[model samples]
Every structure is written in structure tokens, then in C-alpha cells.
Target chain A: MIEDKNQQRTNLSELGEFGLIKHLTKNFEINQPSTFKGIGDDAAVLDFKDKKAVISTDLLIEGVHFDLAYMPLKHLGYKSVVVNLSDIYAMNAKPTQITVSVAVSNRFPLEALEELFDGITLAAKEYTIDVIGGDTTSSQKGLIISITAIGEAEESELVYRNGAKSNDLLVVTGDIGSAYMGLQVLEREKQVFQVNPNNQPDLDAYTYIIERQLKPEARKDIRTLLHALEVKPTSMIDISDGLSSEIIHICKQSEVGCNLYEDKLPLDPQLINVCEEFNIDSTTVAINGGEDYELLFTISMDDYDKIKGNPNFTVIGHMTPESEGIHLVTRANTKIPLKARGWNALNG
Target chain B: MIEDKNQQRTNLSELGEFGLIKHLTKNFEINQPSTFKGIGDDAAVLDFKDKKAVISTDLLIEGVHFDLAYMPLKHLGYKSVVVNLSDIYAMNAKPTQITVSVAVSNRFPLEALEELFDGITLAAKEYTIDVIGGDTTSSQKGLIISITAIGEAEESELVYRNGAKSNDLLVVTGDIGSAYMGLQVLEREKQVFQVNPNNQPDLDAYTYIIERQLKPEARKDIRTLLHALEVKPTSMIDISDGLSSEIIHICKQSEVGCNLYEDKLPLDPQLINVCEEFNIDSTTVAINGGEDYELLFTISMDDYDKIKGNPNFTVIGHMTPESEGIHLVTRANTKIPLKARGWNALNG
Candidate 1:
């Protein structure tokens, strides 16, 4: 479904390794005070002063992580960076710099790479993070993107996944399940178009969910809001592999059980409607759906008053004793054990 | 030419993502004081205090960067980590942590991955670095490795490639051209084996150069030796892409020209023998052939006494004014303009 535009294609070999890297990263401006030198050298240098540096990396492979049929090159680049930044935010750290390494086959043109860099630059500008250093190389097959994000935070402000107490409240920022439903919509349209090539599917109604899949933003605001309210989370994680999987990670690390209230699970109206239209359960989609770059955290009981009625967060669960086990209380009053059916690439 | 042995093949899907990561990295001990947390977290937290963080990343594709016909999986993993560490050492920094992201097709078994991780863990131990974090996913083709190395150094001790003066002396650690010759030997053996499958090529004489190609070490000792002698380099870079290409980078970035003495270029005895056997010029091999992983740097005239006649280093060139242009002065008293004929992946 991805049409190769019959444009002037410039071979990547015209520009050597150094020339290609320079051409792609020429417009990235260094705005972070922590960054001393960015690109052009053997490595990027950063002076973090007294702040603790946090580093996270993610690898996205073509065919496995994304299909080019529906995913635009620019949005793929933006989402690749966002995915790594979300990990840094999960650590309660402010991302300062990122190094992007991409390997592409010869089928791609110079113009395609330029479009990818355009999206990368846009994300760097929006996040106020400097593009520090990266490697550009040739692949034998499809494209592979590996991004490493570097961030900083004071020792006192840093949160880990092993600090939740038994009575702490579990909270999540923004809505869930939209990104997964968005993927379903796009996939369905792809199959439909495969059978009928001239079909012009109306995608206006799926704009919000599709955007969630294509250009999801890392929760950079939650860190600021928690700081403004003087409430530090006891434990935190990014909902990348779905809410159930992330909850299991937090619980396994913190040595506590949780009771997630199904009725309190936040969902966008569009997502609810899409699930019904597709004959899928909204709760199952919300619990098992992946690629939702939202922040999930647990705060102590004393900090509940500060966040109780806050619109930026929803208290969906509470940590219980380890013996209680992890369960989800259905709206019908039956409690069932939660399962982490998150997307696993290795399973394929 | 790579043979798949009929052995116990454990499918990757049986372990899942987290289980596989944990199984692979369980033996990685956090020995660096700067690494506050390693693995099992959203991001690895590092405390470098006042030291500047030096970051470098490299991407290696299977067929484009390496061939599995002669290169073993374990050696590939070891070389991947060493390559990134070379960049960190080029900046005159001490590497403390590394994140390794690997993408492989389903053909590889768990045992094969364990062998690769064995080499990675060995390099981590030898270099005194912690395996902080990484991402493992499925690839559509052969293996792809992306490694990011993090190091630290004081502001005064850190070196850049743009600090060389007109009168600075260029120095390189260890002999060059061995890795390149090693590849030639392997390729020759591979060709012979392809023609006659049972041809047993004697490789005892090529052990040194073969090891240089298979398991190269970054110049970790060079930083310590310079620190002990109190001689800081004005400019530094690793010799991953041959001496001539690296010299061009230093001269161009430093806004100076270089006159490299052909007779003074270091060469291993084995490399010289192999070059003669192949009927190739040793000097050409040393200048144009790549992947040596040595440290090439420049020092001020005042510090020449500290480095002169040092067995570990060789002073092969001196910097000139920018208008002079980079050149190589041969033993025959002919000056030839230098060209960066480094390895270019996109050329394929």
C-alpha cells in the first residue's frame, strides 16, 4: 500500500558517510545547557553538574515494529524518539539529549531520509532536547532505528519502580486503548484497500485514535505538575506494553499487590465507540493494548488530597498487601486476576 | 557458507521478552560506582558528579558491516562493544556503562544468543563497564547491533578533535593495518572453502592479525597512561577507519594541514608479511584499509618529551597551517595529497 513516488531519486552513495550524516543533522540546533558538544566529533560531551544522568534505549525494526504501508516515515521517526523519551519520563527525569542510530537499505532515497530527519528535528524542537550524536549506516534488509535518550534529575526528585508502599494509590495520566484501536483501524483499512484498490476510505472519524498511534506524546507535563503540587510519586512507569503489563512490573518490583477498578479505567469516547463498532470489549482493549505512551505512578496515602480531584490524573487502583495478589474488580462486582497480555515481538 | 548445526534449538518465543532479557543480562554485575542502577528499570541512573558524560553510539548490520561466513557470533558481540568503546576512548574519557540493543531473526536460537551475550559480558568485564540497559527485539533479516557507550572525564582532561595546533605532533597507539589484513586472510580462506569445501587453510601465522579483526580492544590503557604521564592530547580520535581517513578528520576539524611521514607509520610484522603475500603495498594497506581500533591523537610540542620513544606510541606526523593542505611525505621524498578512502557502507 506504500506507493513509491516517481521522483528524482538520489543515491546515498553520492554522499559518503560523513557527508550523509552532515546533510541529515545540519539543522539540529543544540539548546540544552547540559550538552557541551553535539555531533561532528567522535562522541557528544555533556556536563550534567550535580544531576544524576538517566539513559534509556529502544530498537524498532521494520516489519516487526512497524509496517511502512500505513506508517509515514516522518511519524515513525517522531514516535521512535517519543518512545525512548517516555522511558526517561517514567523515571521522573527531564530528557536533555538523544542519540539516534539508523540503518537503512539502498531501496530508500535521500529524499526519504530527509523526511525522516524532518520529523526527528521537529520532535527535538517540541521536547526541547538536543540531538547529540548518532550513527548512520547501510542495512541489508529493511530500516532499523535505535534511539538512546539521556536525561537528568536531582537525586531527591528521582523516582524508581521499587518504592510503592502497600497503601499507595495507583494513578495514570491521559487515556489508554486509543493507540491500539488506532492500529486496528489502520490495519482494517489496509486489508480493505488490498481487496479494492480504488476504495477511498474516510478516515476523518478515526483522526484522534490514529494520531495517538502515529504521534503520541511522552507525558512531560506530569513531572512538572507533580512538582508544582509538591507530591513525589513513590513509584512510576510508562505504559508502553499496556497497563496490565506495567502494573505487573511495578508490583513485581515493589513487592505489592494491586486492585484495579474496571469502572475507573479511563478511556476516550472515540476509543469506546470504536471498540463497540468493532465488537471488542473496551476494558480488554484498554488493559491489553500497547503503544500508549502515558505515565503510570503510585503516590503515598498522604499525597492523595493533593491529586484526588485533579483532572490531569485518574486514580484507577490501589496497592494492597502482597498476599492479596493482583486483581481487577469488574464493574459487575466480580474480581478476576489480571494478566499481562502485552505485545511481545519475540513471540512471533 | 555458514553452517547450521543440527543441535538443540530453543525457540525465543518460549521465554518471552522480559524473561529473555533477564536471562541474558543476569550475570552483568554493576561494578562501576557511577552506575547507581543497572537494568531492571525504565532507565539506568548514573551519577558522574562533576565529570562530563561522553556518549557515543554505533550501528552494525549483518551483511553490510560484517559477514557471518567467517565471523563467529561471540566474536561479533565482542567487537560490537569494543567499537563503541573506541569512540569513548577517543574523547580521552573512561567508559563506565554501555547499552546494547540487538535485533535478530527467528532463526537464531537461545543458545546462539547466550553465546553472543557471553562475548558481550566478557568485554564488559575486561573494560570494567556495566551493562546498564538495552532493548532486544525481532528483526526481519539477520542480526543488527546498536550499542551506546557512556563515559566520564573532567572538563580539563576531556579532549576534542578540533584542538590541534599547527605545530602539534600526531601520535598513534599500537600498530595499524593488522585488522584489515586479517579480513583479507579470512576472505581468502572463505573463497578457498567455497571452491573446495574441505580445504583446510593453515592460520597459525595469521593469529595476531586475525585476533585484531575478531576481538579488538579499545585503548583503555592509553587514557590511564596519558593521565599518569600528565600529557593531555590537543586532539584525539580512534583509528576505526584507517590512519589517512582519521588524519584527514583531525586536520579538517582543527583547521590545519598534516604532513604524515610514510616511513614512520607503524605496522605489525604479521600484517607486513600478509601484505607481501597478497602482493599489495603495505603502506597503502595501512592508510586505506580500515577497522584497526587504535587511538590516533595530537599533542603540543612541549609534551613531546613525555611521549618520545614510548614503546606504546609512534609519532608519525606533524600539523601545518590550513593553507598547506594535508599530505603524505613518502620515503622517496614525494608529497602526495591525502584522501579519506575510509570504508563506506552506502557504497554497497
Candidate 2:
């Protein structure tokens, strides 16, 4: 990454903190009337009118959360912003603005920072969210990205994880395990590259899974389509910790149990092939592999008729009384008690 | 730290994401009515009756912001929360709530986390701000702390850095340079201890300065006292970036000039004594030393009479015409142009 040298560059100290802020944010027009004031005071002022606000925050570290070798700065920056937006979408709200703060070490050149900001600016444009305000400082080790996204929605349309009741149908958006399989594929190729840097990564066939991990999209459209169809989920949570883990969260919070069918667990063909090649059970991967970025929700049984056959969603299970406990029906007709073994299995 | 037998014994995977949140926040109580929902939903919900709300955030890294070797987890936790609250005070608003999210490695024992939360709980009690919501995940490396503080104030009551006018007097709360001296002392002692662990550090004389570094207080009282005395700052910013940089910020933002007097610079006696011992200039430390966490502001000439001899403040300078630029009248009876070395000066 080469620094931009054509324009006259001013040292940050030349303008001081306040001047630097004003200079950098000069062109940042506040399109949202909700932004009462931005970047002139100790904090930005927000006005949401009568609508309630949905707030979510996420932290992404350089070495821990991502690797600069394979992960492009643009993609890393884009993913960091999208991750927080997914949380807002999960709440069924329209993300309007965000505050992005970065802590970086001197090891990164100024050109590297520009690349990072390029991705951030691109994502901000795509999301139609104004970059309101944030603090930037130096870190001791790697770069740290912390984002706080603010969204808005009517009080009645909001969703919570504790709203599920007995007999509600569980549904999942898109497919599961692709992102996890993608991660595996990347790691294997990385090892291959480490052993021989000249080895070309055979990523053409693994495009679908790799894209899942590198650029997973938020289910913001799912919320819009459901609203258009007049179907509200009884309870919903994003599939970040895998389907089994998220399902357990809904069940525990809603005071209900569930029985998911192993045959109905959705999987991409490429992902299944990759899992098979790795000698891991495809079912285990679907149930436990994380970072899917899909939506897992529970809808009332009466409303299930609206989209039971919809190509975009899959009906996997139904909630039962809490005392019954959660279970999984296998293809062999044997029932297994569902315990949250997603991440714990990997750790042990 | 030692590991806690009871709490430390449970694995994070056992609780998963949702369960971990519920288990950790079980002891936390919601004291602010504006905090409609917290922790369980995809996003936290905030409902405020006021027309506008103030939001601010900060990130504290492991080594750059703090040293784990000497700084205890409890103080780190306290300092993180206070830093956000200080920003709210700078806006002349009372902090009502905060969302704290942290990521740390498994190297930390359960007792260490408890000690960290112990300080958070204590700060909540002292500041009367609710710990509303947060996200927690396993970090790959060191500890990372991100806090977003929300406060309420009328549009007219809020202060802006652009509000300063010519002839306004620049004032700072408490003293400066002590925190910088404290850091030097701690660093020196750390080097000594590293050479011989068995040797005891005779630090009784440097106790005050060390505490100033380890546990700096935000100028929360200054805002309240200013309100009580019926004096409002024309423009304000917290002094986390040293006095020289802060003065430059006010001048640049307000489009005015300033003239500071070297004799008027405030310094704790211990800071002066230690600076002398270290063969360092106390004025340099006062001008460029950071992490003071004090309030720096300008007041109009009309209100100057009310705050002239106040023990809690020092009028270090006065605003001048924009063409005059910022100047420092040296003790040698010469006017010298002021330069803000800022945080970037560390490289020199």
C-alpha cells in the first residue's frame, strides 16, 4: 500500500484534535435528520423522533479476529462494519448511523490506514449509514476495530429471543455450515502455502464456501420480506454461534424445548463434500460450525402455512413444553437429547 | 491473580453466548428507566423522553493504554468506565448509562475477571450509571475494553468547542503534569524490580504521584460546581491529550487565538520535585504530558469575575484575535509561539 502523495498532507498535530476532527469530517454530510449534531462536542447527539433505537457494538482485533496476510484490509474493514449491522438487522431495525473507532500500532504504515478507511468508506456508502463520530488512538500491539451501530424501528415491530411459545415452528434462513467449511478450506490452503509459497491456491472450486466466510451478507432482506408478508417470528436470533447453539439460546430464553430433524438440517453441496473430505460428519458441521451469519427464528404454528414451502427458508423444528427438554430426531429414527455441544466439542 | 475455585471452574462454552451474558449480568440491576431492554435481545433498546441523547465511546488496549504487570484488573476496569463518563461531563451532561463490551484471552483467571467486575460495580455505584448491556467473546491475544456511554441534556445546555469567542479566559481543572511524572516513576520502579525481584521499592514518597497514574479521576465535580456557581464554559474538551494540544484544539475550533503564561501553568508539588530529580523540565511535562483526565475550557469575560480566584481551577490563558495565533509568554519576558507536540511527539 502506497501513501497518497499528490495532495498536501497535514500532520494530525498541526490541527490538534478538534481541528483534525473538523477537517476530516468536513465533507461528512448528515443525511439522516435523526443526527441532531455530529463531531462538534464530547458526544454526537441523536434524535430518533418517536421511534425506539436499536444499539449494537462489536470489537474486531487484528491478529486475533483477522490475519492481514490473506485478508485484504478492505474486506476486513467491510466485514467489521457488516458484523455490527447484522445485529441491528436481527432486531428488525433499519441501521441509520454508525461510529467507528480504531486503535492501531505504528507498525502499520499510513498507506495501510488509507486502505482500511477505503473499505470503511465503501461499506458506509453501501449501507447508507452516516459515519457520525468516533475516537482514534494508538494501540500497543495490533489494530483494534470497535463499531457501534444505531438503528430505528417502531416499538411493535421489534423482535426478542424470549418470545417463543409452545408449538412455534423453528426456521432458518439460507444454508448452514458453508462459512465454517470455508474457514477449513482457507486453513488447509494456508498450511499448503506456508509449506510452499509458490503453491497456487486451488480456490476456484471452493468459491461458494470461501465467499461465505470472507463476505457473509446480513439477513436484512429477510426482515423486509417477512414484514411485507405479515409474518412475525415469535423469537429470533442470528446464527453466529452455529444453528445448534442459537437454537439452544431461543429455547432457554423462551422457556420452551425443541425437536429438530437431522434430515431437515440445511447444507450446501460443496460444504458437504468438503466436510466429507475432511472426514468430519456433515451433520456435526451443520450443527456446530459457526459464522454462518444466517437468521434462525421461531414462528407461530398458524403462520407456518404462509411460507412452509418458501425456497428462501426451511422449517426445521417445533417448540414444546420446557419440561420435555430439547431433542434431535435422527434419520435412523433414534432420538438424541440436544445439549449445547457446538463450541465445547471443538475446545475439548 | 489467583483463579477462583467456584466461578473459574465453569467453562465459558458450557454457558455459550446467551447463557454467559445472562449468568454474568444476573447481579446487575437496571437503574435507568431509559434502558428499556438489555443483554437478551439482538440489540439493546433505549427510549428517552428528551429530544436528544449524547453518545460517546473509547477503547483501552492491554499494553499501550495500560500495563497488566503493574496495573491491577480492578483499576483498569474503573479507569475504562470513568474515561467514558468524563466525555459526558465535558458535554455538561449527567451520565445515565453505559454499555461495556470486553474481549480477553483465556490466560486471565476467573479471580482476575471478578476483580475487574468488582471495580465496574463500584464505579456504577459511585457514578450512578447503569451497566445496561454488552457483548463478550474470547480474544485471541490481550484484553480489549470498549465502552459506550449515553447521557441526556437539553440542546441549549450542551457545550460545543466552536462556541469559544475572543477574550474568553482559558481555564483547567485541578493540576497537570502529575500523571506524566507518575508514569515515569512507575516505569523506573518497574525496571528496578525487573533487575532484582527480591529488592523492595521504597515508594512512600512517590505514592501520591503513582496513584495519580494508576487511578486518575475524571473532573466530574468541576461540571457540577460550575453549574452551582452559575458559570458555563463557552467551549470545553477533556484534557486526555495534554494541555498544549487541548489549548490548540479550542483555538482552532473556535477560530480564535490564545496567549498562555508559563507562570500560570498548574503543577502538583510532587510533579515539580520529581521532574527536577529526573532532570526534566516541569513546563515541558505540564505542556505535553497526557492522561491527566482533567477538564479544559474557556469562559467569557462577563463570567470571569465569578471564577477568578476559585481554588479548583487555574486560568492559564486568554483567547485573542485569530491573526494573533496562540502564544506563550515565557518567564524570560519573551512571547514564544506555542506548538502542540501532541501524542505524536512520543516518536521524538
lDDT, model 2, position B192:
79
TM-score leader = 1
Q: Rate the local accuracy (lDDT) of all candidates.
A: 0.92, 0.80
lDDT of 1 by residue, A1-348 (tens): 444463888899899788999999998999999999999899999999999999999999999999888888889889999999999999999999999998989998898898789889999999999999999999999889999999999999999999998989999999999999999999999999899988888988889999999889999999999999999999999999999999999999999999999999999999999999998889888988999999999999899999988998999999999889999999998998987873442123
Residue pairs clashing, model 1: none
Candidate 1 residue-wise lDDT at B252: 90
The TM-score obtained by chain A of candidate 1 when compared with the true chain A: 0.97
Runs in model 1 deviating more than 4 A are A1-6, A342-348, B1-6, B342-348
lDDT of 2 by residue, A1-348 (tens): 111232433344445445544554555557777888876667888888788888888888776677766677767777788888888888878888888788777666545555666677777787777788887777767788899988888889888899999999999999999988888788788778789877877688789998888777777789888998789988888887788888888998899999999999989999888888888888888888888888888999899888878888999889999998888889997887876755455546
* Count of backbone collisions in candidate 2: 0
Best by lDDT: 1
> For model 1, what is the error of residue A302's alpha carbon versus the real structure, in angstroms, after optimal superposition?
2.2
Clashes in model 2: which pairs? Answer: none
